[model samples]
Target: MLNKSYQQRLEHDLEGWVKNGWVDRQNTGAILADAARGSSSTKIPAIIGILGAILLAAGVVLFVSANWQEISKLTRLLLLLAAMWFTFVVTVWLKRTSHDYLLEAILFLGAAIFGANIILIAQLYHIDNHYPDGLLFWAVGTLLITLFLRSRATLVLAFCLIVSWASIEILEFAQHPFWPFLPVWLIAAGLAYWLSFRFAIHLAFLSFMAWFFSSIDLLIKWSGFSDSETGGLIVLFLLTSFIYGLVMERKNSPLSLGFGDALAHYAISGLLLIVFFFQVETIEFDGWPATLPFVILAGFAAVLVLGTFIARSQKIFNLTDTALFLGFSTWFILSWFIPALNHLWLQAAIYLGLTIWLLIFGQKQYDKLLVILALIAFGCQVFYLYMETLGTLLDTSVFFLLGGVLLISLALGLEMLRRYLERTRDPQDSRSQEVAS
Candidate 1:
């Protein structure tokens, strides 16, 4: 039955193919029969072997001549170009005679040529662009080739180009005076992500790496470090590796999620940390009012929370949302405890009230986490107030009041979640029983 339905859908899609003169309805049956027979496509490994042998031969020659001081850079570049051109011509010919594997071989050759050309040009000109022009050009060229050849190898090359560009740009930003180029690298990374989604290859790892590097660079800059400084580079690397592991588990590649999540997380964390630490010192030391940091932190925390929830709902579960939530929660608690906010009790009450509202609305959908976080937060607020001995009786009274209200709210919230789960499960059990019967 499922196969029949799939065939119907295929026939429906192919109806347009007949209209466009791509295929005919009368030949659809034959095409389907041929497809069912499973046409034997050429594997990529065969072409890889052939191209690998040729490249290895060339590499040996290049390595043998490495000690030759008389070899001009231009001569080396020309030789590289000649080799690439020859490979291209041969691969194209093989594509005509052989199969898809030849196309993949050509794409691999194109990528090597692209990188070699960039290094050669950099050496010949004695100039470092400090931007990802090489990677950009290679990615564009590889993307074109992928489109023309319809080869996954070319697409993978494009993915690698974007990932490499992101990594290089981040390193450049950290070690050179090239902060301005970061946005361009981010845009390129975004384009790579969009392409991956279209092609369905799951390059999330690449995207994550790009974002992770960019974010760390920005964090260092925001922390008042010079662009060329190497203070937080190690931390960035470690954090990137940790996050990369998480991203790889969820995405096919770390680059697949693009750099947006990492960008957001770093930006929010840096901004919050700056406000919490440096901003107040800078303002107060300069004889400015201390209230400025509070206002700035409050506004920033609000925006971060709003943005994080929006991203979470949109299913963007990268590190950014997690960081934003943490930042906002910390900011909220600190703001209440700070010397500026005299109405800590009132603010705690209001927060508890809002949390209860969220639990009530969210629990019906089995959102236990929301209610659980709210409950934990309520407990913390009460504990914080209890610890501070500013009118102990008054503080203890407020704590008990908030705690009682939260406990009651949690009981109701759990009941709602229980009912929702029961309602959802009953239908599944009934269906199972019906199937068994």
Candidate 2:
């Protein structure tokens, strides 16, 4: 939902546009209505309801914990069961009343209590040997509720539970690959498609990513740590995901999605985070070698980039979009293949160049969040560079001075570009944003 301040700003700008003869005065109201429609104002009560449910659940747990010594097993079980049934009753009432969001919250609470009751009863019966199994049971039960209720909230909860279950199995029980999770993620994806919930799609993707990253050790067990740098592999994965987002976002492409922007944002954030680790120069950099995983990863990333390049409708290279990807991809692959490109100085230069590219991207796209992200990333990079490279006061002082000037210059350029873009932005584009929102 858009903030009130942002809405006010948009309204002010719309009025100016109306006065400038750029937009018809009569259409302004319709435009504002579209922008304000389906916003958080209507959803806030439902959110509060859900949050209250969660808080109530937490409080109940705390009470149970506090009275654990005093309460008998049967009484505790009965209490949890009663609470679970109570929520189900409330769910029926809300459903009859057509309070969908409240019904969802009640159902979610029931699901939580159901999961808790399972393990609690198991503990009482002395069958809670494998706690991770409890998580799986909880996830499965939640998914059943999700399926029956066709709830967005419960679907998300199920996704989280399943991921937690798989994570615990892998981390605590040495369950290799977590094979069952793949099918479960597919189920979640299918359900998301059926529901047409964009956030659920994000959760599905995240669950899959979690499964892959968590199972990396077991998936590559034969190679051992000597055969690969996990960091390099992760960076490659992120790069590939970024490219996939770009490819999927292409309007003319066969595959397109409304959620591709979110995926691209995640990949960009991951890339910047890795660059942060790079600048620190202390996050277990083993110097990627020509290993099997490296070769596979690099090849996969290359294929993605090349495939998209071949499919790109624009004959001219778009630096604003592709610059950051190309810079990082070249450095990442060449750093191992060509030793000369592996130096820290070159890496810094590449990342520095990427920061500027991201700034331009943000301005060109009229994304204030991305602009803010770029600024924060640049500031962090500078701070880390200064901290890592210490010297005599005069040398350090001069370096800081130059860095400040460079940063200020970038900021000015970003502001000027932002204004230019704002002026040139078509009325249709603003309407498109409202529709997208």
Candidate 3:
């Protein structure tokens, strides 16, 4: 389902289209009415139903916990099985009755309870091989149910459980070449795509990124890849994904359905994250393999350049897009060569500048997702700069005071700059419109 805000905006646009004669009044009204119906339907009731189900599920668990010792082991086990069966039975009835919202809630609660059941059973049998093993079972079971019921809520839960189990196994147990999650993630990702669940796809992408970053260094060390090779591989992966997204965007591929917007964001974020690692590469300063980071920088520049040409060819290129590309590429490349950029203040400045660019671009394009990304980047940089610079200073209170003042000053300066840009750009925009007219 589309977000309420988006649906409302779409309805507004439809009404405008009617006035413009792009759509007939009758058709426009019909579409808007349908959108209103969709937007209003399922949201409030689903939310309330889901919340109630969660509370009821929790109550059941608490009740079980209170009487856990009173019941025999067999009885306890039987009760858990009964709960699982009962949930499924209720799910079937809900499906039969076409109560999809309540079904979703019940399915989610059932999946959660199933996880609890796994742990309980593990404890009952005194099975101890690693706690993640039980989680793995739980993930599989949840995924199976998710597939059977085609439930987005359960799909997300399955991904979370599986990703958590995989991360724990890899990080804590020194599990090498964690190949299992690749297939699991692929399956989950495929399912998400099939279901057109953008949120689930985002979670899957996040899970994949977590796995990649957590295991990349270890994978490189184990495979005897040098820093340059490791960097090259990472750069290649980022470029490939970005190019694939661009290709999909150009072609309007069905495969990109439900996630075209996210693909570009992921690509941009991957580049930004790579830039961040280079921004903090002090530990290995001795043998700093600048090759890969530089390659990534070059790749981004090339993409920006290529994209400019493509956009121009399509008559879609604009000043804002040019500025967005140049801003990020320049910041990324300059951060590498400028020794002064190593300072936390300078790093924060660069990040803040990028954040501002993203915000401006988002505003110009009316892309809410881009605005959200900008806010996230701003918050992250603020937190990082604070953490990195705060403890090193001798007088903590003074440091904080200075930091707060600096931030306030920067905010004011940025606002002034934004106003100046808007003022300057508006006249040029009006002139261009006059010329086009």
Candidate 4:
């Protein structure tokens, strides 16, 4: 009995040991397999990088060796189609890759090839005979590619294409200028904005450039100083600005508000400068007798004040107001000091009233720029009147007093209403929270 018991116990112990060993081995095998998979995954990025480099090199060679000028028109078209196909294939391959950087680099190279192909095709066919149509076709193709690949680079290319077309139109119109085409350009801008909502930030950036260039083109034409070359240069500047803004926005590590504000300011300033420069000459200064300047100044001031109020109401930072305000100030200083308008006192007064109105209404808006503009306008008004026209002060006293009283009353009423609403909402929120709890 003792011998049998010992054998049975020994067999049971050996079986338990074998089971434990099997469990450990299973776990060890799983860990080793996972490690091996990870090791293989790490190599994918390197492979993608290699492939991207090769494709980029191939694209460059193909672009240079195409002998675009020597090729027949049909041959050029065929080459363009082939280049586009290659780009599409490469883009698809990059999309399937696990490496994002490699994918981005490949997309950029593809975009370059895509743009080059269009330009070459245009050259071969002398599409300038159709003027804007050739550029428009290029824009459409690039825009379609952007939509398909969802590539930011393609979005930029589309923007460049549109701006190029618009610039050509502006130049053509300049020498034999037409009316009513401004609205068409605006439509193009709207299309760009619409595209941005569907695509990436690239479309927004491009739309901004298109709008800016259109504005500049309009300004130049309006100012009677527009030439094809100048319009082309403006288009180039618009692109440069777009690129600079994109780079700055991307590079900002901590993402300060100031950088974004500055960029917005730059864009707005560019747009306003274009508008003011174009319209300044046609303002009918002699007939209006200072009315035009006052109107212009007030228009900008109103835009600033209203824009601030809307921005505050929306609870977002909107630099449009600041842009318009700065633009107006620039025009005021330039127009006032350089040409030295008659009845500058009235213009200065109008500007001051508008500024004071903003300060009182927009005090709660948290925008430092708006407040500064108000102060500047006030100081300019006081200085101009006190130094330049002492007699006009007496005449304008009633106007200033009435304007100030109205603005102050409106500001106080609005503030009181806002406080009341906040106080009422706070109690309600607390009660809801208490009930939920």
Candidate 5:
């Protein structure tokens, strides 16, 4: 779907094209009208249909709950089968009728019902075994339906089920369960790219990130690294994400899997957010032997800094990009020695500074995503500060007063800068287009 701003820009450009005799006004209007009609299918009807599906599924669950004890074992099994078949049949009918929104809704409902059936069936039969098996069943069933219907919505649901299943196994086993997850995740990624399911692609990336972090953490623990050493794993994760992002951007990765450098973008953003949350506390080590992880941390930091510089020289890394990587590395490396930097106040100050710098850099680059990330970081810092406040009247008053003033100033400055950039970029863009034409 087109972003609202982009949609507006398209309309504005279409009007200009109409005026310039580059396109017929009536034809442009018809094209826009067609797009509007197509988009409407995914709006109200889709919402209402999804809500209806959820309600219907809830009602089924309620019925099952009410009659579960009275029903025989076979009857219970038959009931679940009937529900699945009924939902599938309705989905097919909706598809045939070109009720695309309702079809998607029914598919989602079917997945929910299928998962419920997996758990309920196991429970009713007293065949309760490992709990995650239910999730595996749900994942497989959902994925089959996704493949059959070629539904992006169902694909997302299936991927979530798959990820959840893997996470459960990891937690339950207290180790990385790479056996099923690795192959399953690869299959999910392949399907996401093949179907061009953008949300599914993102889910796949997130699932991989979780798996990667968990695997690294498990490996570190197994290798006799103390819990204090896990920060090194995160540093490594961040470095790998940056390097991968540089590679992906350099390759000009295909859009079939959706946005380019999606893994890197998510990994970097997620790792930073995680660090903000947990970096306030320092984990102490016992002796010099425990300091081994810090050596690894330093190595990763150096690699990140060196790789970023190389990327910059190759034009893959912009100034803002280099600064971001180095900034994160600097903060992490400092935490290794100046344990006091993990103090709440210092962390808040660093986050605040980082957010402000991001705002300025994002404006310079005209990067809306980075600007949004900066805003989110600012919000996070504000929330963290509020949580950390001493709650004394004077401190509370001062905190609110300063925070309110700073936020207002930041908002106004960002707005003015964005407007200025928009105005300046438009003229340059138009001139470039004219020259190209």
Candidate 6:
């Protein structure tokens, strides 16, 4: 499937070709129409179909629920099997008839039916094993279907089941790492590899991120810590290390797929967002996390950083990236000793600094989107800092007067800067294949 970046780039390139007179003006529409016809990644129709499928699945489930007492248990079991198989047969027929659009939605519906069958079957038999096992069964079954069909839609279905299963299992069973989750996630990743699906690979990346954060949450709890803030910092540091590995490895699909440096883009944006959320004061922690998890996670980060430095370091991830993360981790790590560094204002300051650095870096990289977002983040952090100050100094009217003026100027400046950057980074700047979009 063509990615959104490639889709937009293709449109831009087609226009450029027409302008250069390499293609006939009248033929441009036909060419683009042909391209659109071939591209399977178009979301609108698929999204609509998936929504319809969900509603259809829901209707079937609701119908079953509404008449459960009227039917025998055997009838209920057969009804579910028939519904699941009907969707699968439809998918196969769609494939054979070359109906690509509806094929995905049918496959999605089949997976949904199969998933519902797990629960319905359990209730029918009155079997009383751990119910998360039902979700686990659904996950494995959907994963197999995904692999067999090499369907991105079913891969998504599999991932949804995995996440739902983990959520239930973790919340029900106390901090049990849910270690079986690892193999299921790995299988999902393998499906991406098997099909060479770029979007599926991104789903894999997200799956890993969820598992990483959940595992860290459990680790913090096991170490006898309840402090949410400290755990956030630790997760950020470890995540940075993970991102470093992703950047250094430079994983990509086949050249035909046109997936370049997407991991780096996601990693960079992810780090910025993580740091930005750190300053939000709504979440409170009881106390600091135990030193053991912090030290162990830091050491794990050190090993990753060190390995990257050893293996063609600057070629992929550079010195500045290392230094920035080092500074970020050091701030919270030292808070354990100094305590003063843990102030909200100080956290906001560092996030502001990081925002500024990102703007400068994006300027150098010619990533207009990055610069625009960084400007927004910078303005937000400033506002957050001002609000924090207001909470303490509400008795002094003078502070609010000054803050009002500063905030108005900041807001106007941010809007102007973002619009200017967007105008400048238009069709000309988007000519690069590196994906300015």
Candidate number achieving the greatest TM-score relative to the actual structure: 2
Tens digit per residue, CA lDDT, model 3, 226-340: 5544554454555446545655666677888747567767876776577566666652322333565456546655765676556546444366556565555555544444455
lDDT by residue (1-437, candidate 6, tens digit) is 34566668877898899886668889878877777777665657777888899899798777665656878878888988998999988988988897777888888889888877877877777778988888889889888888788778888888888888887877777546668888888888888777878788777778777777777766556556656545555545545544454444454335324334455456666665665665464445445545765676567667655645643354443576557756665664454445566677567657776676667656755768668778888888777667667756653345447656765786698779878988988756658634744
| Candidate 1 global lDDT | 0.53
lDDT of 1 by residue, 1-437 (tens): 55556667777878889986669679998877765454333343655654684485457345433534477776777777887687678777877896645556665666566566665666667657655876777777767665655555556667767667756766664533344445544544455455554332335443554465557655655554432222222323223332333343334455534443343234323333332332123221122214644454456555545544544554544364456444435544454334353255555555555455435533543546545655565565556556654577875876687678767887898789779999999999889878977
Predicted structure 2, TM vs. truth: 0.76
In terms of lDDT, the poorest run of 10 residues in model 3 is 283-292
TM-score of each: 0.41, 0.76, 0.69, 0.43, 0.67, 0.67
The lDDT for every candidate, in the order shown, is 0.53, 0.73, 0.72, 0.52, 0.73, 0.70
How many angstroms is residue 187 displaced in model 5 relative to the true structure, after the best TM-score fit? 4.2
lDDT of model 2, residue 147: 84
Query: In candidate 4, what are the lDDT values of residues 1-437, reduced to their tens digit?
Result: 55456555645665665575534544544644554555545656655764675576466546645665665767766766676577567667756784454654565556556656666655655566656766676666666665566555555556666666666766664522333334434544445444543333334444555555556555656654424234323423432342243334444524322244444435434533443343223333222214444554455445444544444345342354444444444444344233343245445544555456446434654546646655665665565455554677775676567767876887798789889999999999889878977
Error of 4 at 320 (Å): 22
Clashes of each: 17, 0, 0, 0, 0, 0
Model 3 C-alpha lDDT versus the unseen true structure? 0.72
Model 3 regions lying over 4 Å from their true place? 1-15, 60-67, 174-177, 232-236, 246-250, 283-365, 371-437
Candidate 2 lDDT tens digits, 327-362: 667676445344465456557667776777777766
> lDDT of model 3 at residue 421?
94
For model 6, the superposed segments whose C-alpha errors exceed 4 Å read 1-48, 68-70, 172-175, 207-217, 223-270, 273-348, 366-369, 391-437
RMSD of each candidate? 13.1, 5.8, 6.8, 18.4, 6.1, 7.4
